[model samples]
Structures are given as structure tokens and as C-alpha cells.
Target chain A: MSQLSGNTKWSVAKLKERSPVRWHERIGETSIFIISLASILLIMLMAIFILKEGLMVFINPSIRAEVNFRELFLKTVWQPISEVPKYSLLPLIAGTLKTSFVALLIALPLGMLAALFISECAPKWLSEFVKPTIELLAAIPSVVIGFFCLMKVASWLAHAYEIKWLHDALTPHRLNTLVGGIGISIAVVPITFTLCEEAFHGVPESYRAASIALGATKWQTALGVVIPTAMPGVIAAILLSFGRAWGETMIALMATGNAPLLDLNILHSVRTLAATVGAEMPEVVVGSSHYHVLFLIGTILLSISFTVNGLSQLAISSLRKKLTGG
Target chain B: MNANRRRFRLPKGSEASGLALTLLSAIATLIVLSMLAIILVDLGSGGYRKLSWEFLTKPPEQGMTGGGIFPAIFGTMFLVIIMTLMVMPVGVLTAIYLNEYAPKHALITRLIRTSISNLAGVPSIVYGMFGLSFFILFLGRRIDSLIGAELLFGQPCLLWAAATLSILTLPVAVTATEEALAAIPEELRLASYALGATKWQTIWRVVFPKAMGGILTGAILTVSRGAAEVAPLLFTGVAYYLPQLPLSPTSQFMHLGYHIYVMATQSPDVEATMPLQYATALVLLALTFLLNLIAILIRVRLRIIAGEV
Candidate 1:
């Protein structure tokens, strides 16, 4: 009886040690998991807070009475400081879209062409230098870019336009949306070029050889076969660039005249939601209706960026699936 | 006959176009170089004479008419240093955890990755709002150099500006560090484990040291970015003028970025110091460029060493 009891007691003690060891291991894993979860939760809370404060503008009847949503959305004027603060988002929205679209127009072709040159046509030595040089553009801060735009690009554009009689007569503001758009285009090009170049580089050499074997010209192979293979990546690059342009603040603030007036002409001065938030958010009375309105604008900006990024990711995954299946 | 003609023409066409392509790439490079040149020229022509030792060492006098960027410079450095100290460890550790320890397909891991990416896209101004509300108001902490009973160090009172800039640069640091950690060969980890080493010991002893160069490269980039940021500092509390140098961490400090912004936009006497503004901008740009150059150099050295090893 004594010998049997001794064996059973030893087994029980071993089981007890193993259980605590497993418990401690599980706790360590849980804590690490929780830390990551908390960080993400904090960011989401930031988004929710902005949205909550911004939505207050629509919910409160008093603020709604101050500015009609219909007129704010549709009207040409954006005189937010007027006796009746017209909060027409048209001018700001139009300015942002026009500048961003023009930027996209210039950046897309130039960036893709640049990518093609670097990836396909340039010698290895040339590519070695070109890749880093292009990447350096991405590293330059936006404020520095803004300073250049303000001091250099704007004046250059003004001087160039001054020589054209018709251009001067047609546009009063030399520092207009067009100038801002062009400056922003310069900023986006490097980014697009980097991503697109990477995508093009990822294309297999076998595909290029296959096309060449079929008697396709180099340009023809690149444009027809390689580009199609990298289409999803190219689209993702363009969308990401667009999102960047849409959110850019300092360049628009410095180059655009900060005029809140609504107009379609690329020559007209304009304001963006980002610029507005930057210029005015500091002075805004905390928790006031105007303050909340600014937060709402942030929410709008976030939503737009989220949509663009989401679409890009979706397109990339779908393309991957298709490519892999075939 | 057709085959001979095509074969003869193809090499010639490619060579000519290749030359043209090289030229275009050169021009693309020139565009960036020219922009930098124009900025340097404009600043030099406008403010080179005024960039004296006194201009960099003295405090602002007579509403900045006497021309001093000492306070601003101190504030920028203090903010960047503090931010780097706070962000580097957290960012590097989190990166290690993500790359080495975390299970793939875990919800928490995906959330962290997505948030960091999304945060990168959020505008600087929005970060200002978040900082102002959470750091200043919600915490009920005045933008001063003290926390309860402790004297926190650095100019612009280091803590506030540090927190703001840390948030701004965290995503970059985390992303870069993760990339570095990911680049480590799995065999290294397995070798250590095969020798009966614990997982943490293996990562600490082997993986991190190998990835240090890339980690430092990322840290340098983060510091450069933090130094250039203007919008967030505006809200977080960068004083435009300081009568005394921020010799101690507890001293009130002014920052260069805010001073430039003030000189350019809000100065009461813009005409008198227009050149001063340009010079200040020049100094800031040069500083950023130099920092970036250092980062690139480190990256190149690492690649070479990595190759040789």
C-alpha cells in the first residue's frame, strides 16, 4: 500500500507542474496578442472619434439651420467666414478633384514610361543609378516640395504664362489650380514610377522571351504582353498615387491661392479640405460646431482614401488569383 | 531575304532606342537635381551673407529682426532626438514580434499591419488634431517641461513634441524594421534552435544583430522626417521665439520649422527679413538632404557588407 501511494503521488506532482507550465505559456501568447490588438483598436477609436464629432454637425438642428446641407453641397461659393457661412463643398471638392485628376493625367503616362525605360530598355548600370535617384524623390519631405513649388515652380509658371498673350487674357490668376496640379504631379510621378517599376521587374523573363520568339518588337512585347501581365499592379500604383494627391496639403496650401470660390477653370485659385483643415484646425475652438465640421471633413478624407486603398488591394488579389489559376 | 533584313535592322533599332532611353532617364534624374539646385541658388542668393555663426547661435532678438535660428534648431533637434528614443525600441520590438513570433492568419496581426499602412496615408493635419485632443486636453497636461513632479528634458519641452512626431514616424520605422527582420534567413533561426537555444535567445542573439544596419537606416529616415514635419509641431507647441537657449531639457524652446513658417507667412515685417526666411528654408532643406544622404550611405554600405559576407 505504501509503495503504490508513493507512485501515485509522484504522477500527480508531475501533472501539476505541466498544467502550470502550459498555463504560463498560454498567458504569454495571449498578452502579446492583446498588445497588437490594442494598437489597432486605438487607431480605430481615432477614426470613430473623428466620425462621431463630424456627424454632430448633421445631427444638431441648430448647426444644420446655420448652413443648409443642400446649398453647402451644391453652391458655388465657399465663404465659411461670411455672415452666413456658406459651407458649399463644391469649390473645395472641385479644386481637389481637378488638381488630383490633372496630376494623375501627367503622372500616369510619365511614370509608366519611366518605369518601362528603367525596367526594360535601360542598361544595368543606368538602372542601378536610376532606381535610387527616383526613390530619393520619395524620401524628400512634402514641406520641402511645397517650399520649392512656392518659390520656384509658381514663379516659373507665371513667367512662362506671361509670354502668352491669350493665356494671360484668359486667366487672371497665374497661381491657380493648374499650377498646384502640376506641382503635385511632379510629386506623384516618383511614387508611381517606383511601384510600377517594381511590378514590371516582377514580370518573368520567360514571358519577354516568348513574345520576342514570336517576332514581336521590343516595344510591342512590352506594351502588349508585359503591360497586360502587370495591369493590376499598374492600376494599384495609379490609385495609390491618386489617393496621395488627394490628401496632399502643404503643396496645395502653398501653391493654390487658398480661395474658397467655386470654379471649374484650372486657372482659378481654390482650397482643398486638407488645406482647410491644416490652416484652420489650430485656431478652431475645441468641441465647437465648426470644430466638429473640420473633423467631419477629416472623416470624408479618410473614407475616400480607405476606398481607394481597398479597391487597389481587391484588384491586386483578384489579379493574382486569375494569374495563378491560368 | 526578309530574315536577313529583319535581323540586320533589329539590333540597330534597339541600340538607338536604348541610347534615347538612357538620355531620358538622365533627364529624369536632372529634373530632381535641378529642383534642388534652384532651391539652393534661391536661398544662397537671398540669404548666404546672413548665415553667420551668430545667426545660428543667438536667440531671437527684436521680434527676430536680428536673425537667429539657435532656438529653432535646438527645438528641432530636441524633438527629433526624443522622438527617436521613444519610437525606435517599440517599433523594432513590434517588428520582431510580427516577423518572428506571430502566427500567420491571426486577426490581431492583420489588424496591426493594416492600421500601420492606413496610418501612413492619414494626413499630418489629422495627426495634429489627434495629438491636441489626446495629448493636451484629454490628459490635462499643459505643454510645459514638467510632468507632475518630474522635470522632463528637452526644448519645446520634449515630451509633447516627441509624442506627436513619434506618431508621425512610427509607421515608417515599423515598416522598415519589419522588412529588415523579414530579410533574415530562416536557417539562422533554425540553426540556433538546433543547438538547443530558446526561441527568444536565438532571435536576440542572432537575428537582431544581423538586421541592425537596416534598422538604423530606418531610424535615420524617421529622424529626418520628424525634423521636417511642420504642421504637427504647430499644434503640439513649438514656440516661435525664445529669449534663452534651451540648454537644459526643462527650458522652454523654439523650433526652426515653426520659425520658418512664421517668417514666411505670419511675420509682422515680411519685407525686412524676406531673405532671412529663404535662408532658414535653405538651412532646413540642406539638413534634411544631408540626413537622407547619410541614410543612403548606410544602406549602400550594408548591402556591400551583406554581399561580401
Candidate 2:
């Protein structure tokens, strides 16, 4: 091997001496560099175009007459098709928050408990079964989840309302914030489970060993040591899932009844920012204020997702360094 | 020492608490599993009778209330094909650059990583919005103006939707290929170098073949993603119902997800089309599921090979 290396190095040097430039290699590197830049380029163009069109609500004269930053941020109604055409983002924001709140309320505990079960409690065979089941669940498309929520979950909730005692607890609306939240939670749980499981897995084996060596019970060690050490990751998971539920479109559009109601009732149908875009963008007049407003909603979704994902990335990296001693 | 000692103590009822928590999480897992099970059972039982060769091959009849969803299946396949052609070359090359050519810890590399992660996190509807504004209104219209065509390239069509979806799934391909590339031992590249192979030659001749499985996995995953995506296509190119197949890149196409969405929401007689909705959903769910299963199997095989490496 050394001889081969030496002979190749000598020949390569001689060859290089003969030809001072390797044009093909340089071209190859440059082309690959350009191709690799496409992702960055695409992302930049996405931000630019989305921002340009979205910000038209402020810049365009006609759009500005009907809508302004104050109307978008300060006002509460989101009726963009009326004669007056209000474009306040507060209702949509409230809707996004309410649905995400319901999603997190259900998903957080279930996801964390499932992660705990798989990582620290379940047998190996059981973990194997559960992990792939979660993956399969993750692979199920959002649209299908939306369809299911629309067809089955809503009907089931409606039926649940029929029982006299459960009336107060249930939403009277068949398709409401609670139903959308449940649908989003289905999408959110796999993500939460995967991330939290990784976090739990990242807690070094020695930590568990030491805790066990000290005569601590398995659940005691898990609850006291592993979960706490992995708390940042769990938090990151929750944040990421929140971002997901916040930006989720199809399920919300399908299940939430597409009403921009500013009510606090979980049973009341609400329209989310993402869902509003999906539900309205197709029918919206091109180049109208409504079009720009939808784009603006897109802008809001883009920025919120970017921020949430960035923070989660930071949390994961910090957790990695702390737990892995990197 | 005293604090540490107290912290690790096996207090009374610890065992019972352990049992209770374990049972509780097990129930949580059961609920999650049942969620999957309920959807599958509902879709399968509801859709099974409706699915047939005729249903798979024939076009919808009576305003999508009666007949099959052949056009949706065809358009989805066509969309996936176009997207695969567009995404694979760029996605694989991006992975090659990041894993093989990138200077470690460089600023530009960090920028690319950040961009990819952000792209992955951007909502699908945002992609739809971006596609509408950027690809359709901006780039497509520019092409139309350059060629002096009247609304030819400016409208939503198969090409633009595929382009939008390609970008959305680019990170999936890049990540998978990077994982595959990273798994190759450093010694292999060194050996190729020692044989007087240039960097490009080594990657093309030696590393690329070894990473082929990973690339295939990426392709399958990308195809499945493109097939499943409907939000971005809402405005880009997908039609509510096209009379003819999208035989050209410039033409609009039907999509399975959009079909289901439109039928479930906009159909005048939602009750009449319930069976058709279930069948279409099942077909879509099965397509994505099968593709994902293939990808996972390939991934597991790659892992075994990577372990050997």
C-alpha cells in the first residue's frame, strides 16, 4: 500500500508538473458548487417572492387603502371578501394558537409518555413494534389525516355530543377547534415521540447504570435522571411540534370549518393562518388585496416556522454537546 | 454527598409508582397505536369493496360520484416522475458537495445547512404560496414574456407543480444521500486517491456506486412525498377535474390528494361520494405506504452495509 501510494504520488507530481492546470477538476468542483447552491438559491427566492408579494398589503396603493399593518396586527376580524374587506390577522393568530394549544395539550403528555415507555420501560420487542408503528403513522399524509378527521373523527365527536352527561365537555360544532386539534395532534405525536425518544436515548447509559447501582428503581431513575437531563430535547420537541401544528394546513382546513370566529370556545370553529391560505387562496382573485393578504399569511407562517425550527435546532445541538460531551 | 444520597433513595411506594407510570405509558402507546389502527381499519373496510381494476383504470363518472379515479392516479404518477427527474440530480449532487467536497466548518457550508433545515420546516402551504408567486407569477410569466407567448407558460401547469414539489422534497433526498455518503469509510477514498484517481473520478467511479442504494432510497422517498403533497399544487397546476391527461408540461393535471380534498369539501353531494372518497384515500395511502416501506427496507440494507464499512 505504501509503495502504491508513493508511486501514485510521484506520477501525480510528474503529471502535475507537465500540466499546471487541471481544468476538468476545477470545472467539476465549480459545477458541483453551483448545483449545491440551488437549495440556498431556492430558499432565498422563496423568501424574496413571498415577502415581496406579502408586503404588498403595505406597499400597493389600493391594497394599502383597505389594509395596513395596523389593520393586519391590531384588528381582530379576518373577513377579506366582504364589501369592507377586513384583513386583520388576530383572528387567524388566535385560531392558530387555539388549535396548536389543543394539539400540544393532548400530544405532549401522550408523546412524552410513549417516548418514556419505549425508551426506558418497554421491552426490546415491544419497542421494535412501537417505533415502526410510529414511523408508519408519520408517513401517513396530512391530507389523509384531514380526510379522516373530516369524515370519521368529526362524526364520532358529533355522536359523543349525543350522550347527555358529556354535552358540556364536547363541542357542539361537528367540525371545530377540538376536532382540528385532535387531527393535528395525530400528525404531531410521531414527531414528538421521535425527538423525545432520541433525547431519552441520548442520556448516557452510565447515568442509568449509576442510578441503578445506587439502588434506585428503574422508573425512579427515568423520571428523576433521564427525563430531566433530556428536558431540553423534550422542550425542543414540544416547540417543534407546536410549530408543526401551527403551520399544519389540510387538517385544519378540513376539520376546523374555516370560520374566523374570535371565540374562546374549543367547540367553536376557527380558521388558522395556514388553513386560511389553503381554503381561500385558490378562489382568491389574483393580484387583489386578498391575494396579497394570503401571501402575507404565508409570510407569517414562514417566519414562525423558521424561528421555531431554528430555536429547536439550537436546543438539540446544545443537548447533543451536553449529553455527548462533544 | 448527603444531597446525592437523598436523591437516589428508594422511597416507599416507588415500586407502585413505577408500575403505575409504566401502565400509564403503555396505555398511551396503546392509544397512539389505536389511532393508526382505527384509520387503517376505517379506510380498508370502507374502501375495499370500492377498489377494483375498473376503479383503478376508469375515469370518474357523474361528477366524481360514481366511477374510478384513473386520471388522478395517472397524474400523480406523472407528477412524481417529473419531480424525480428534477430533484434527483440536484439533490444527489448537493449531498455530494456537502459530504465529499465541502470544507468542514466553512461559513458557506453552514449557510447551506441552515437553508436546507429551514426549507424542511417551511409549511407545505407556504410552498404552495411560494410556487404561486415565484414560479407561476414571476418565473413562468417571465418565460412567457421572453417568448412573447400569451399566458402559455404563465399559468399553473404540470412542470411548475413538479418544480414546487421538487424543492419541497430536496432536503429529504440530500439528507438520505449525505447519510449514505458519510457511511463510506475514509480508507476507500484514500485507496482511490492512491490509485491515481482524481477526486471527481473517485466519487464517480468508486463512491457513487456504493451510494447508489442510498440514492435510490432518496428517490423513492422523494417520489412518495411529491405524490402525497397537495397544498402546493392547490394553485400551482392541479386542476379540479381535467378532461384530458396532462400530456404536456404546460398542461394542468389531476392529483389524488386534491381529488379527495375537493370531493370531501366541495362536492355537492358529499354523502353520495363517500365511498369514492374512501377508495381514493386508500389508493393514495397505499401508494405512499408501499413507497415508504421500500425506502425503509433499502435503508435497513444500507445500514447493514454501512456497518460492514
True contacts kept of each: 0.23, 0.76
**Error of model 2, residue B209, in angstroms:** 0.8
Each prediction's total of clashing residue pairs, residues at least 3 apart in sequence or on different chains, is 3, 0
Expressed as tens digits, the lDDT of each residue in A183-280 for candidate 2 is 99999999899999999998999999998988988998998889989988998998889888899988998999889989899988999999899888
User: Tens digit of lDDT per residue, candidate 2, span B42-106?
Assistant: 99999999999999999898877888899999999999999999998999999999999899889
Predicted structure 2: lDDT: 0.90
Give the per-residue lDDT digits (tens) of candidate 1, residues A219-239: 767877788988888888988
RMSD of each: 5.8, 2.9
Quality of candidate 1 docking, DockQ: 0.33
lDDT tens per residue, model 1, B1-309:
998767545544765775676677556555644544565576667768788888878776777777578778877897788889987876776787788887788886777887777777777776776666666655434433346534233222446667777877888898889888988889999999889566666777899898988998899888988887877766666667767666654455677766776676677887787767776776787788788888888888887877942
TM-score of 2: 0.95
Colliding pairs, model 1 = B72-B255, B72-B256, B154-B249
lDDT of 1: 0.74
In CAPRI terms, where does candidate 2 land?
medium
RMSD (Cα, Å) of model 2: 2.9
